[model samples]
Target chain A: AQSVTQPDIHITVSEGASLELRCNYSYGATPYLFWYVQSPGQGLQLLLKYFSGDTLVQGIKGFEAEFKRSQSSFNLRKPSVHWSDAAEYFCGGDNQGGKLIFGQGTELSVKP
Target chain B: DVKVTQSSRYLVKRTGEKVFLECVQDMDHENMFWYRQDPGLGLRLIYFSYDVKMKEKGDIPEGYSVSREKKERFSLILESASTNQTSMYLCASSYPDSYQPQHFGDGTRLSIL
Candidate 1:
């Protein structure tokens, strides 16, 4: 079965610090990868997505993700974290089926 | 912006009662999905509809049914509510392309008593 895995359940980082959230997936083929963030009392928003070429994809809110086919990982990263960036992050994959398979999710805490 | 609206932000229902969760999308997307979010299990797709009067079962659709009588509306139905059915339900819509990303609603947090 196709699956996505976000190893970290919760991560804490000080404001202005760099942030990196890891994600891995298992699938028959390298599917379309995506990163979404859900803030408190708000809906989930698409951060970025990787469809084809250019392993490094930039997204909204100063976020970027790199797709590594060798490791089957699509990790999200930010050079500097902000207080408002604290939220729940999810990694997902679409096998060209219009259905998304999402990871459990990582709750990020930005401390000042 | 693509606006996908869920009828309720929160809901409470009694066991054995029929329950309905309504969703509407203004983007005129060809695909709509209903997913249940659980703390450690992530989001599980219950059902999806691609067109008017067309529906398909998702991974965890055993206890749920869906209706899409119109182009912009999709409804999820629980035949008999149960405590285990309590969850954060999310509604999303997207274009027909498999690679198209979906736009979501603010989710309905339903509690079954």
Candidate 2:
């Protein structure tokens, strides 16, 4: 069975500051990793995904993640975060049939 | 763009009432999934359908049942609503062979009283 862990439950960052959300997964083989964001009362939006390729994958809204197989981590990062970026972010690993094992999610609070 | 539609945005049901949550995807994807979202728990899969009339139990499927009557429609059923079952329900659809992202609906927030 595959599982994902996000240690940070909540993170607060000032506007224009760099931010990183940690994510680690336990999977037997090469895993498909994804980052998704959800605003209050809204559905989740895909930030980015890593199937196989470059270690660093860029995503929407100035977000990027690096897949580190050695660390079993795919952490999301942004150089600058805006107030609109305040939302809950989730990291997930894809199992067979595209079933996703999601982390507990990290709620990001961007202060102005 | 893939459009997954959940039938309700908000629902209020009494305990012990039978509840049905409907989902429809327009992309003709081969896989559809039902998940429940709660604060601090993220999203937990309730059930999924790989093909029409084929269902599979997910990580948390004990309190829920699912049906996939058509290729584009998948439904989640609660035989008897309970307070613990009250949560935001989400429906998503994805292709079988493609690594394409799962498209989600706006979600239905069900409250059991």
Candidate 2: CAPRI quality band = medium
Worst 10 residues of 2 chain A by lDDT: A92-101
lDDT of 2 by residue, B1-113 (tens): 78899999999999999999999999989999999999899899999889999999998998789999899999999999999998999999998853578889999999999
Model 2 C-alpha lDDT per residue in residues A1-112, reported as the tens digit of each score: 6789999999999999999999999999877889999999889999999999899999999999999999999999999999999999999888675888899999999999
Question: Model 1: residues >4 Å from true position, as ranges?
Answer: none
Query: How well does model 1 score by local distance difference test?
Result: 0.94
DockQ of each: 0.78, 0.67
lDDT of 1 by residue, B40-85 (tens): 8878899998889999889899879999999999999999999999
Per-structure clash totals for the candidates: 0, 0
Give the TM-score comparing model 2 with the true structure, all chains together: 0.98
Which ten-residue region of model 2 chain B has the weakest summed lDDT? Answer: B95-104
The TM-score, computed over Cα atoms with residue i paired to residue i, of candidate 1 is: 0.98
Q: Write the per-residue lDDT of candidate 1 for residues A37-87, one digit (tens) a residue.
A: 999867789999999999999999999999999999999999999999999
